[model samples]
Target: MPVLSTVGGSGRSTVAGLLACALSAMGSTVVLDTGPRLSSPWPAWSSEPGTGLLSLPPDRPLTRGQVHAAASRFPAPDGGSWQVLTDHQEWSHPPLPLPSDPAAWYQLSAIGGWQAVIADTVHPVAHDVLTARWADSTGLTARWCHLPFSVPVLCAASTGSGVLALQTAVKAASAEGLPLHRMVVALAAVGEGRSPASVKAAATMLEPRVRAVVQVPYDPRIRAHGIRDTSRLKSRSLEAGRQLARAVVSSAEAAWGDPLPAAAVPRTRAAAQARVHDTARIASKKVPA
Candidate 1:
């Protein structure tokens, strides 16, 4: 599952961590960070930096061990640890040497011993899809967001603009033939107060379009410090995480059966070439090379 945001600063990564923590507490899970690593917080979550995706060789077939070696594990609720795949490299240059292909990451998830994989994406995927960006996208967005089994968790802050952004994303997904009925809209509380009438009204309009609209309370610790020890987090906040996880799992089942498709992971050479030419034809916006 991909935890995607409609806009930047929607607490997208934080929401992804919450989902990963909750999901890992149940069973094996790997939370892969595919966002811009320079701005990503996954590297700081662990004391020792993970090898990440760049550590894996793209030419060779991926294995569970290779993926595990690249990931850094974090403590979970049930005496287990959740693996996180992210680039923790230190760079002061033009671009980071991330794998050009995004499918390798997905292939690892299918092969790796994990019950769930939460991909924290950076771009506004719904908007891109609605705009036909997928036709040209050769990056992570095209691979995961369009996958049959990948249930998307669209996030937004619980405010006027946030709610409006989320509603717009929902409409975009519907327009792109995405499974909106099986999509979960995560409305995270930005502050402590009753939601504005506009937000409430927008959420009401959104209820019938998507599977469920859930709220995550604002935690002061997260605001001040950042995502660290879950034990230090408020109980209500943890409960909200559980609620969001349940909703995501249910959506997956409804959209793609109990066990999601294990195939359709590998991107063919032909497809890659097509995306490249198409992207060049439309715009110079190619994914990290």
Candidate 2:
């Protein structure tokens, strides 16, 4: 699963951290940091000195076993353990090349000791290693400055380039046999700033465009202390995280569609070429004069 925001400041990283923690409370979960924005707050929040994915040598592609070994455990108050894999601050390494094979990336979560893997990625992967096709589901974050029905609530074309970018990525991924389960997170509504009617309206408005809509109230605790500080987390934010996790898990389970299929085949040379062709076609359709 990829936690992606079309634009910056949609609180994608915050959501990813909470989602990973919530998932961990239920089962083993690892959050792979592939984005450049903000580093995973796990290290700052955890009591133990931790290791990150970037700690491993970047000379060769990382293996699932290696990934598992390198993961730093962050224990939740409920006794569940959350693991995080990110770059280490101590080492100066070159930009790492993510696994080019989407299937292999997918297999990492399916086969390993982990129950789920949350991939934190930047938007517009045109230059990034993790392309849209690599994701089985995308947690898209959209900001709502208004309290109720407003113009461009779902996709403010003039203000939000992320909407179009996300739509394009979803379409392209679908074309490549990866149907993205879109979990839209509506952000920046606090206690009085949020109401049941507003939340319901937002979900209803987004229902047609996304699989599910989850609203996370803006918590001053998280904003001030960062996501790593669990001690000061607000109850409302925690509940929202749990809700989002349940929705994501349910969507994933439903996608399996009873009697999960056998393991997927690796991407062969021919398949890679076909993917290139498909991507080129998609690009051609969008290119302007």
Instruction: Give Cα-based local distance difference scores for all models.
Output: 0.75, 0.54
| Model 2 lDDT per residue over 175-289, tens place | 5433334444444343344344544554465567555666677788877766665546888777877877877766655655444344343344456789999999998895667
lDDT of 1: 0.75
The true-versus-predicted C-alpha distance at residue 13 of model 2, in Å, is 1.1
- What's the CA error at residue 289 for candidate 1, in Å? 48
Model 1 lDDT-worst window of ten = 93-102
The TM-scores, one per candidate, come to 0.82, 0.63
**TM-score, model 1 to reference:** 0.82
State candidate 2's TM-score: 0.63
How far out, in Å, is residue 35 in model 2? 1.7
What does candidate 1's lDDT look like per residue over 1-289, in tens digits? Answer: 7888878878887788788888887778888777667888888776545677777766666677878888887775556667788877766644455543446556667667677888877777656666564465443444566664677788898888988888777776666667778778888888898888887888888889888888888989878766666767887877887888999888877777777565455554557889999978878665578
Output the number of the TM-score-best candidate: 1
